[model samples]
Target: MAREVDPKKTRKALRRLKRARKKIEDSEKSDTLSDWEDEFLGSVEDRLETFGSAFNDPEKGHLDEALSGLQTAKLREIERKAAGKARKPMSRGKGFKSSFKRKGSGPRVRDINEDIEEETPEADEIPEAAAEPSRPSGPPKLRVVKGDKGDT
Candidate 1:
């Protein structure tokens, strides 16, 4: 025989559960809890533990550990989002095609050829008399004389 559940008792229990959940949600938003709230949460945790979920224990510092882990994960996600935003989308299609001629091409080639012609003397042209050596003109040339150490 199935024992029939009392609808009134079930409704009252459901309302109480809803109220507790609301309180917890409000506490989470405020990020502060009074002693009574702590005691209430501890009792809820004990009830949850009986069901084998083993929710975070404030006395064991598990709350801080969980909070730190959550904060780190949130920071990492924020960093990832920021990095994603920072990247620019790659340009598609042909992109910027410069109309200017490259080096050694077009007018530059003509300028280079003219420069080369100006620098080089024609083979048939008679060269001017070679200039006097600049160094020997400044000072007497030094000659190295090797002598036996014993003679020195």
Candidate 2:
């Protein structure tokens, strides 16, 4: 069964479709579109003429919407091409997720503390006094805990 559509939305979509058609036609006068692009425009116009919308799948768009999200995106792309823009290839974002964030994507900066640590000694550094370094029986920095509870 055909989904019911709003007449107002249908009229708006038709106007947009006509505008897209005009854009393609105007572009052809200066630079020609690929055979597929021309066919795509023709097919879209035909579909819109035959049916209220270009797409039949309800999941592709809302019942009242003339174009689906993807359809609108493609239309925009077509319009860009009509404006003589090059067809740039789609690329994945430089991220693990779509909305990923980070400090930067450039070369990593050296930590200031690393240079300081190399120049000086750290508390964690093993003493060179030991001829052979062995795991001591006690913690590295032994301290006596003196408290009222007689922990000392």
Candidate 3:
């Protein structure tokens, strides 16, 4: 003979299902997604189906055990997947295009002499050539030798 459903247990299960659904909806709102929410929803749905199909009291305990395991694994899987997504941009260099110019683009042309000229003092500001040490205009004169004995 099949066991009959207890009214209290059935009502409690229904309330739990409703709460799980509400939690799932709330978790998915605006900016945050809870990793456990989907798992909880699926677990509740499975438990309700098991209760309906078995029509037995002892089966609820088995459903609870299975639900707990599934929910734990699902939460872990969601965390792993989320972490992988977070790591992708950092690992891939975040779309950095190389700034290096290609070969044959020719060397960069710049007015290097103009830059040097700007830093140099003006010619007029420098002292005239008169301030320079006077250099001998012609070859140096040779000295004549004198004989001590007056020999010609």
Candidate 4:
């Protein structure tokens, strides 16, 4: 039995491919397209035309999708580049200085020796009775409280 294919997905894929190609072509007149980008567009167009989908591997993309998520992202990136938009920079994440932050500007942890070297005068000022927690005088008092007897 032949596998069922959505005519909509096929048509949409073709439309997207043509638009991307047209964008690239138009951009090429004013800007240069890298060899890899040109080759990528051509290969994807060919694959879609011949196989009805650019990739067949389920691991690469959904069986019904013409372009994988990564493929679509790359396509958008190319489009952005062609349009003269700058690509967003990657994040360095925490525990490191950010692009805007000046060197040694962030809060720094002091050395253990520095804490030990500086003795606090407050330690001697506190009274001995207040310094330690109060001891319990005796065993806690017991109360024979009666609950509502209605449930029983």
Candidate 5:
């Protein structure tokens, strides 16, 4: 026995499924902070809290400016550290040449010009239809391969 599905209910269900899928995709795409970011944010929060505590009711407006300046300085420091770390690898003498050569041995370099040239078909060349057979026209036929009973 088959139960009839209501068109209105089916449409509503599909809309809900689409919304759920969108929500999942959006959540996956949202920005996530790394360990360094978390640390930087924590430091900024601590500094802001301490700075805020030091000020009285008279200096609330000035406190905001000071906090902004502090944040900017901290951010600059973090950026400088990150940049320094990035440069460290390049600063080391072991560059591209050293990477390819055997360690503690004489430089056995290969000339790039000696490599074999590859022939590419010109734009005017049309590939044979036999190269790629057209998909079978009609419903796809499913094949079930029989395996040994012991295989499972």
Candidate 6:
């Protein structure tokens, strides 16, 4: 016969499992510091600790303010770095292959504009169904409709 677990032990195990799952969910939602940020924060902590030991009780409040200011500056620098990266141009051609020498029957890889032209039908090759498809003759117009109290 298989050994049976005690009810108390089973309940405790369930509670621990629930707590572990909650902890994992919370960690996933939280933003973790990068290696550089962690190093900076560690240095800040050391600075704070040094200040704690070097200064007397009278200057503790000033130390706290200094720590807060350093933390704010660190956060702002990280934000500025992210914003600068976002503003950088995306036309660097990263991951784009410049030459093609394949062993198969496929056209060599082309750039964005060339790929579009290759995929679309030529102006003369379009069939009647596509050559004169039904479409509005001119640009679409937007009109205001009257609502309650003649308000648009």
Question: Which of candidates 1 and 3 is the stronger one according to lDDT?
Answer: 3
lDDT of 6: 0.47
Model 6, position 7, has a per-residue lDDT of: 43
Candidate 1 at 74: error in angstroms?
32
TM-score: which candidate is best?
A: 2
Candidate 3 local lDDT, residue 75: 42
For each candidate, give its TM-score against the true structure. Answer: 0.20, 0.56, 0.26, 0.56, 0.20, 0.23
lDDT of 5 at 60: 39
Mark the regions of model 3 whose C-alpha exceeds 4 Å error after superposition.
28-152
| Stretches > 4 Å off in candidate 4 | 1-5, 90-108, 111-114, 117-152
Candidate 2 Cα misplacement greater than 4 A, ranges: 27-31, 97-152
Where in model 6 is the C-alpha error above 4 Å? 1-26, 29-31, 53-64, 68-70, 75-152
Q: What is the C-alpha RMSD of each candidate to the true structure, in Å?
A: 19.8, 8.7, 21.3, 10.2, 28.1, 22.8
* Candidate 1 structure quality by residue, lDDT tens digits, 35-137: 5545644554454334322224445423312222343343333333333334345558564546543677445334456556455555556445543344545
lDDT of 5 by residue, 1-152 (tens): 22233445334433433343344345543333346654655554454444432223433334323234344444444444433332233346756876776667776689887796877667467578635576899998999998778853
Winner on lDDT between 2 and 5 is 2
Query: 1-152, model 3: which lDDT tens digit per residue?
Result: 54445546555555555554554455534333454656555655565566542223453444323233444344444444333333223245534445654578767689778677456466677688635677988999899887688655
Better of 3 and 5 by lDDT: 3
The Cα error of candidate 1 at residue 117, in Å, is 99
Q: What's the count of clashing pairs in each model shown?
A: 0, 0, 0, 0, 0, 0
Q: What is the C-alpha lDDT of each candidate?
A: 0.42, 0.72, 0.50, 0.73, 0.46, 0.47
Error of 5 at 16 (Å): 34
